[model samples]
Target: MPRKSNTDVLALFDTLVYTCQYRLVLEPASHVSARVLEWRQGLRERIGLFHESYHMPSIILCSTELPPEYERSLVDAIARGSEGFASFNMNIGGVQHSEDKRTIYLEVGEKGIIAALRQRVVDHVRTNRRIKKLGVEVVDHARLVIASGLKADQFNAAWAMLAVQSVMVQQKVSDVVLIKRELGDTSMDEHVRTFALTQGV
Candidate 1:
C-alpha cells in the first residue's frame, strides 16, 4: 500500500527545523565503494517496502531549537569554526528505532576520529557567546534516518522485527557534509546548502 501524500507546510517546517541540527552528510567512499553503497541501498529498500519512506537526510550529531535570527548566526559561526577542523572517519554500527517508534535509523558508533571531531564542534558552538545565549546543547550518538512514521498494527509485529534484523550492518564513513535549512523559497542551488568537511583531517 502506498502511503498517502500529506504535505502540510507547517508540518514540513516543523520537521525541517524541529530542532537546529548539526549534521555531517554521509557519502560513499569512492565510485567503487560497494559496502557502504550496499548498506544504504538496503535501508532504502526496506523503508520503501513498509510504505514508510521519507527522504533520508544527513546524520545529525546534535540538535536544538533557536530563535530564527540566532539560528542564522549560529550557522555562520559553525561554518567559520568548521574551517579549522579536519575531516574524520565515522563508523556505522546497526539499525535502531526511536523511542517513540516514529523514526528508523542507523546507529553511529564513535571512534577516536569522530569523537575528537564532535568535541571540537561542540566546544566551538557552546563557547560562542551568540550561540550560548540560545541555550542549544549538543548530544552524542549521531544517526542517519532511514524512515519515519509507522502505524502500529499496520502489519504484524514480526514485520518490523524482520526488517530491523535484515539490514543491520556496519560500514565506514567517508565524508562529512554540513547543511542549513533555507528560510523561504529562493533561487538556490541546494535546498540545503551542503559544506564538505575538508579543512583539517
Candidate 2:
C-alpha cells in the first residue's frame, strides 16, 4: 500500500461527517454517586460477566443534534431555562427491566420535577431555528441504567437477582450539567458547563 500524503489525509478528513450531539443531565451529589457505584460493583459480583462502565448515572433532560455554531445559543438557553430552579430530592431505587426486558435500571420515582425541567429546557431551546427544525427529544423516564445489551437469559438472571434485593438511595439534585460528544468518539463525555439551581426564597 502506498503511504498517504498530507494532502490525501486532509481530503479524507474533510469528507468525514461530524455531527455534534448535545445533552442536558442532572448529576447527583458526590455521596449519592459513591453509593450508586458501590451498588453497581456488588451487582457485577453477583451476576458474573457484564460491561457497562461507560454509562453515566444521570437523569437525562433533553437531547438534540445541531451544528457547532448553535452550541453557544444552546448553552445560553439551558442557563435561562434552569435559572432560579428549585432543588429537589429524587428517589433512585428498585430494579426493573424495560418492556422488552433488554435493559436493567434503577427507578427514579419522582417524575413531576423531571418533566417540568424537561419542558423548561426544551421550550428555551426551541426558539432557535435550526434546533426547532432538528427537534429535541425529551427523556420520559428518569432512570439510571445499570446494565444494558443483555440477552434473554442474561436479562432474566440479572433481574431475578436484583429485583429481590432492597435498593434505595436519595439524590439531592442541585444543578444540571451540559455535555457534548462528537460523532464516532468513544471517549467519556466532555463537560461544557454547569447550571446551579437556586434555593427557594
Candidate 3:
C-alpha cells in the first residue's frame, strides 16, 4: 500500500463538504398551480410590484444542504419514511404572512397529513448522526408561497387584497417530491424525484 501526501488528504476533505440543497415538497396539480399563479399575478398588479420571481405552487415540508454523496441515502430514507402513508385531499386558501411579514402565502387546510409525513421523514433521515446535527426545519405550518421579499406597504396591500376574498381551491396530494440543486444555483431549476404514497383500498 502507498501512503498519501498531506495535499491529497486535504483535497479529499474539501470534496466531502456539503454541495447541494434538498427540498421535500408537496406540489399542487397543474390546474391548481395555474389558479395560484393567477392569484399571484393579481396581487402583483395590485401591489404595483412583486419582489421575487414566480415559482410553482407547493407546500414545502423541509429543506437542508448536504453533500452529494448523501443523495442516494437521502432518497432511500425518504422512500422508507413515506411507506404506508395514504393520499389525502386538501384545500389551498386564505392568506397569511410570516411573523416578519416579509412573505405572503396561501394556507393549506389539511395540516395533519403533512405533519405526519414530516415526522416520519425526520425520524428516518435524522437517525444518521451526521445529518442530525444539520438543520432540518420541518415547521408545523405549511403554505404555498405567493410572493416574498415584500416591503411594509406591499405586504399590507397584498394581505388586505387577499384577506377579503374567499379563495379555496381543492386538490388531492398523492406524493411528495425530492428536489435538489447545486450549492451555487439560485434559480428554481433542479432535479425532482417523486415518491408516491400507497393507495388506500
Candidate 4:
C-alpha cells in the first residue's frame, strides 16, 4: 500500500482560494516577558529553531488576498479602523496542540482588549465590498508557538516531556503589523508593507 498524499487529503477538505498577499498580526516587543524570551531561546537551542522575519508571537486579525485594485482600499480600511485603538493587555495560557497535532502553541487567555481589537478589524473587513465574502474567523486565544509546519509535532512532543514548563504571562500589544505582497515573491514571503499602529499612538 502507498502512503496518502497531503494534497489528496487537502482536496477532500474545503480550502480558501486567494493569492496570499497580506496578514494582520501583533508582534510583541522584547520587553513583553522575560520568560517568553527564555522560551524562544530555549526552543532555538533545543530544536535549532529561530525566529525568522515572519515568525513572531502574534494575534492574527485578518489574512486574505484581495484584488490588486482593492489593495489600497483594504489598506486604507485597516488604517481607519485601527486609528483610534490603543495598546491593550493579553495573558498567555499554557501549551496547546492543534487537532492535526501538526502544531503546538502557547494559548492566549481570553481578554477584553484583544477581543475588541479583533472585532473592530473583522467588522471593517466584513463590510468592505472588495473582500467581504472572504469570511473571517477570529481565533479566540492567540497562539504563541515554538514551532510549526513539517516538524512541529515532533518538536512539540519532545519539548512537552522535557520538564521545561511553559509560562503564563501578560503583554501589552502596541502595534498592528501589516505584511504585504511583493513582486516575484511567493505567497509565503513576509515582505511587510506597513506597521500601522504607530499612527494610532
For this target, which candidate reaches the highest TM-score against the unseen true structure?
3
Clashing pairs in 2: none
- Kindly provide the TM-score of model 2 when superposed on the true structure, using C-alpha atoms: 0.76
Model 3 ranges off by over 4 Å: 1-18, 38-54, 160-166, 183-186
Question: Which parts of model 2 have CA positions greater than 4 angstroms off?
Answer: 1-17, 35-53
> Residue-wise lDDT of candidate 3 within 1-201, one digit each (tens)?
899999899678756765677888899778767877787779867886563344556788888778778778788888899988998988888777799998888789888878998899879888776666655767678888878888899888888876665667788888999887665423553656799998867
TM-score, per-candidate, Cα-based: 0.52, 0.76, 0.78, 0.62
- What are the lDDT scores of the predictions, listed in order? 0.50, 0.76, 0.78, 0.60
Per-residue lDDT of 1-201 in model 1, one digit per residue for the tens?
676456566456546653433333454334323433454456455443332222234555554445455655656655665664555545654667777766666566654566666666666667667556546555455665555555554223423543544333354553445544433222121234344567443
Task: State the lDDT at 81 in candidate 3.
Answer: 93
lDDT of 2: 0.76
- Per-candidate Cα RMSD to the true structure, in Å, reads 10.5, 6.2, 4.7, 8.5
Better of 2 and 4 by lDDT: 2
Best of the candidates, lDDT:
3
Per-candidate count of clashing residue pairs (backbone under 3 Å): 4, 0, 0, 0
Give the candidates in order of TM-score, highest first.
Answer: 3, 2, 4, 1
Q: Mind sharing the TM-score for model 1?
A: 0.52
Candidate 4 residue runs with Cα over 4 Å from true position: 1-18, 31-54, 134-137, 149-168, 181-201
